[model samples]
Target chain A: MITTDLVPPRKGSTMQFGIFSVSDITRDPTTDHTPSEAERIKAAVAIATKAEEVGLDVFAIGEHHNPPFFSSAPTTLLAYIAAQTKNLVLSTATTLITTNDPVRIAEEYAMLQHLAGGRMDLMLGRGNTAPVYPWFGQDIRQSLPLGLENYNLLHRLWREDVVDWEGKFRTPLQGFTSTPRPLDDVPPFVWHGSIRTPEIAEQAAYYGDGFFANHIFWPKEHFMRLIRFYRQRYAHYGHGTEDQAIVGLGGQAFIAKNSQDAYTQFRPYFNEAPVYGHGPRLEDFAEQTPLSVGSPQEVIDKTLTFREHFGDYQRQLWLIDHAGLPLGTVLDQLELLGGEVVPVLRKEMAARRKAGVPDAPTHASRVKDKYGDAEPRQPRPNANRGDNVTGGSPYQDTDEGVRASLPEL
Target chain B: MSDTAPGPAPVRRELRLAVVSAGASDPSSTRMLADRTVAAAGRLAAAEGITLRVDVVELRELAQEITTAMTSQFLGEGLNAAVETLRTADGIVASTPVYKAGPSGLFSAFFQILDNDLLIAKPVVLAATAGTARHALVVDEQMRPVFAYLRTMTMPTSLFASTEDWTDPALSKRIERAARELVLQMDSGFERRVREESWGSYQHSFGSAGGTETGIELDSDLMRLAAGGQA
Candidate 1:
């Protein structure tokens, strides 16, 4: 049976590293073979499971409501993966904070947390796909406002038992309660993912949330400015020092025993990937981005440069599966990464990390902080008091009295 | 080319002027008008003891890159250089030929690729050359609003010349007035200082390919709302 509260104090290395997939089901341009949606879905699960087998820290899946992508329902997939894996933390490349109702996000992710034993975390992103807005009965013009207001509501829902939220985008909630009060009464850690917008950075810092910069195909300089803004704002808000602010970065690489073989094997997939194909040459793309197409040691040399560029980040997630690279190739790449790259990086980063920098947050560390020397609250629902979470209070212990007794503000 | 001798007292920064011309054809009068306006501004700068550096972006040359930028949603290096130059320039001399009773698509598209803050509060001398006087309103009615929306410090006097006005003495006087106003703004460093001092208050553009990061204003309405203040 899956353990419900098995999130032990973070045991392994200082840094948390893993792989995130965009869930694109592309035809292998070199072999002209395409995987069915069913096949792609199964392959993704296998890849995530292999992350645990290889002893990685995290596995994240991106959400897209359109075709050529299969990860529309992230929580469902992650819940299933939760049953399958023992130690790997399941997350999203980003949950669409703009279109998805914050109430639904709070409930669903919290539900996943209970099932996953507090081994769940999610990144929030304003998905750049413009058309997804209207389909969800939202206007693209109000994306920023909707995103901010939704998150504000979502934040309150997880922390407070009886939430009365009145925002511009959604209907007013009167004593509404999000169920399955987070596992161990610990809200999952959130990382705000952004590529270009500084307002998003400001929002992340204002909430004292982690800011993730996905350095997929862009130059390092592009993300550096945004990360710097986030770090400065994080400190400005008194969320510890700038170095203690939570950060995560995304990178991709293909590696082999020999550097030339690694480059040769990945060149075909790089040339025909859907997003970046036909734009620039592979060498140009590699030089401009964090992508490395060389030996495992070379990938380390390139990734270590990230600390030089963006200071002392906490999490590093890579894109190891996409562009129709088959499952075998992907598992091999994972093996090389887990065996070679991450082990050395852990030691190097630990030595260089300064006096007070915080490690990546986990359920255990957060719980320990919240309930030091005392038993943490595990909220059980009071008897269903006839329809309206009657008394408007749903939680068992705190504010056990009705809605009228709930404190204002 | 090593400089062994002591240099003159250094100034805060060199005045940078960018000339953007939107004429489609070679040896077009639109480019000539821009050149004249820049020359007048340069003379005024020298009179005030400011060393000036000039960069010109002929839209005729970058016509394709701007269009590609719209679809690619990214600026190529060539176009990025032009946008960066305008972003950091202390002053601008903009001239365009009127097409179909308005500014040319090539001219407007170039500006479209530039970030909204690329020319924020920079002193600008607006000049235009057209086939007839009937199209002179293109400068005041159309181009004025475009620069206004960008929040640039457009000179009080704008220079508009017809094909025939190229020889008119009135055009020369107008160019002098506009150029003198632009140079006045530059020499006083009014726009530059305002931009630097109030930069944190300006809404930044999306991409980092152009523009600098001025910290966001904590008291701004957007920041207040993002901080959970009431709508």
Candidate 2:
């Protein structure tokens, strides 16, 4: 019999399985024909929809401004997908918080929140590109500050009413408000994404937000240090114990009926993938990085090993698309993932959790309760009127003045 | 009916402006920067007694389109609208956060897909937000070069701010100064271009490249292959 102590249970039913598409519209080399941007785009939509249909929790899309990569406007793409799908949480594989203006980020996401019906979240990163900054009139040196300041502003924009703000990087505002209030009176959750930046982990912990260690490229040790640092800082912030701090991870893997066939079929594609080509051995990558090439059980076993280092996190997003693999091969991988991999993983995880082991990261688990339940619940306001309040304005003076008049302890 | 037409019909001119904010938060600093920039543009429009139609595109809600199936339609239309409006606009106020030593990936991605000629000669006011006073140089070190590459007539005065600056009065003054300079530049640029018939005519000459389709097929077979017959 399998020892329950060896495997841990998850926190909630919301299993966070995400499918990320690189958004390259190029044709497969094996086929010698590229898909139109339209077809590639449609394929992305179908994939996301299928992820949801298969009961996978989230769908993320990467952002690449260059040609062959069709996705340049991830938010606009998510909004369109939001209109078509339901329940499946929408996110970006990498939302460049470094180059884009925080103001546009605020306005666009608010609009998306309205469109997505609150099924939205984002992973903020500075990105790996160098030439992209000049294309947008920005310097690489300012990347860290831009992420920090922009995220700060983004946070306030979602939580505050009117804003009176001034900063070194941007102009000041006496009273500013982004339009299209979020659905259900709640702003979308934020997950700070980072590969090597310990600062990002610190920021996430400082704000009591989720830290997503997209471990697609780095080794487990690096991610462990970052996650551990975040957990320690989260406790420092008086939010909770290290174990209670929310975390997420990113992984990449492929599975087949047999381990050898999985590696054989995946080797060429891995060797050619623009993101990972000419870097390291596929086996090495699979060992150090989150890239797992094997059967369904292998993927499960490898993923479960994450707990040994980083402890329990709130979510896990997987990158199943890379190296311009043919759509057929990708679908086969997904089928194996959804049918064989996820089921057994879920059962094993649950069995472990039932025996008092730790659980996976989840949205509900990450919601920081700053205030105790002793505080009276506030009534929901009219959706239209909610947009009228300004950030700096005294809420007590507004139409819902009575509720806004509540005293802060 | 007169040839002179009563002193050039009072020279009716309208200023179109586009303000892009890349933050996903409501009361975000980038939005504040955009507001300050827009207010400055509004002031310039008021000084010139011109009607200004401002269009603000917030990037957070729109970022999903950067990666998903909507790349071809909604995002395309949205970007087209933004580009067309910008091509016809007199000014632009672009704001973003500095991430990983550059601008946000979403903001950069948005600009990456835009046609190179769309921003040429447009008066752009650039601003950035970061965590520390140290990161203030991103506007100059990072954002300015991108605007310059687009051949935009970027105002020399760019604003950078950090957490400490958010509540500082001096930062507000700097923003005001940038706003003032932007207006002056817009006024001079608009006047010079109008006299030479350079603004609207150039845009007309270089109308959007609605060229014939490339007829390239994204390998549906590869997509099927990638999907491994799951579809």
Candidate 3:
């Protein structure tokens, strides 16, 4: 039996470690077999379940409208994973803020938060796929404004009872109350994930949200500058000190019992992976990027260096299941991660992490933050005002004297 | 408008001259032409008592890396170094051998893959080398528009050297004229002035210039929208 005894117990609040999948349906080059969509979907569910089984803390999935990626409906998949696991925090590697309607995001994720008992969060990204914009009636050139406006609306949808919103990207909302108000009336925490965009970082800092850097595929110098900017801006916006800012990072690693065995095993996958395939040599990629393909100790050593570059971060999500690695290989990879890599990383990180650094944001901590010792607000819709539009005070506890305004007609 | 602070006096001690030559062979004529143009430009700058430090980005050496960057978005060491050199360059000499009556594909691909905002308002001298004078218009007709799209100031004189022109005085005359225009543009400090005065007006993304354009303008419309204000 693979025991998780080495896993660091959650001590009030500490760093959270997990795996994030882009839900890619790549062909396994070793076996020359491609998993069908149905098979890949099942594999994704298994991966999330296995992540929780091995004492991992979070499971985040990506959003893609294109083929070769199975996760178009992240909440549906995450909600299902939520039902299967007890302690895992379900999230999205990124939800397309540029393309998806924020109303749907507010409603769906709020509902997922409720279903998962507030064990959920989301990372917003302006997706790289340009064609996805027009399919959703958006222009890619305006993605920055579209993302900022959508998040602005989504932020208020969870906080305000009834929102009257007018923005450039979307139609106006008059007395609109997004239903199934967030679990315990506390919205799921948000983390903005960006590879290079500072406006996204600025957006994250402006709202005091977490900033997640997808730390794979590129050198650390590029990410270091952006992360530094985010931290300073977070402090500038009065969220907290730079060190207290919540930061998450994404990485890719392949580990084994020995360094040579790990490299030999992963060479085919590295050379054939979709993103960097037929491009850089495996050894060069391993040397230049955050990709760690070596023994568990080696992987752990490389991962520990992240804190040195980015400073004490909160969440670290790895991309272990992509590049057409079989389900068995992925499970073994997770076992190594949970049984050896993360456990050691946890202790080392905990020892080195400075005092006053915040842990990854969670629903329980956020709700406690909101309520303190008092009872949390339970929003109850007021009596129907005879139309689809909500009253000025949609909920009973909005205010004593607030009322709806009718047209002069 | 009133918030603009004249921060520090612009530094103009040494001008960076980046020469991007797309010749494939060793001691290629394209590079020779580029070298001649650079030498002429250097002489003009020395006459003005300005130091011109040159950085040559031989695209032939970076051919594989450029293709890799285009395909995988992974910039190798050489390509990144070249980008950095070009990013800091005050003036540029772009010399490409005419391939099938056009600029070399490798040369065009290098600039095509760079961030659109990287070369904004920078001065460039366009030169092309071909086997015949029939392809002389290639620099004006083909390349000027590409540099135009990048918002670079292509010098008024375009340099083209055919097999015979290399031995002719007219080629020397064109190079001298192009070099003069380049030195004048660089000495004018046009790029530094525009970037210092109006960097925000140009369309830019974070990490555009090899991750150097990280300035956050808080007063932008997008930043306003980020702060929950109307766009």
The best candidate in terms of TM-score: 3
Error of 2 at A341 (Å): 0.9
Sort the predicted structures by TM-score, highest score first: 3, 1, 2
What TM-score, computed on C-alpha atoms, does each candidate reach? Answer: 0.81, 0.57, 0.91
CAPRI verdict (incorrect, acceptable, medium, high) for model 3:
medium
For candidate 1 chain B, the 10 contiguous residues with the lowest summed lDDT are B1-10
DockQ, structure candidate 3: 0.56
Q: Rank the candidates by lDDT, best first.
A: 3, 1, 2
True contacts kept of each: 0.26, 0.00, 0.75
TM-score of chain A of 1: 0.94
Residue A230's lDDT within candidate 3 is 93
Give the DockQ (2 decimals) of all models. Answer: 0.26, 0.01, 0.56
A19: Cα error in model 2, Å? 1.8
CAPRI band of model 1? acceptable
Q: What would the per-residue lDDT of candidate 2 be over residues A116-200, giving only the tens digit for each residue?
A: 7657777778876788887877777777665676677777776665555665566665556554444433566778888655567
Best by lDDT: 3
Residue B162 in candidate 3 has what lDDT?
A: 91
Local accuracy of candidate 3 as per-residue lDDT tens digits, A312-380: 999999999999999999999999988888888888888899999987889989988899988888988
Candidate ordering by DockQ (highest first): 3, 1, 2
Superposition error at B123 for model 1 (Å)? 3.8
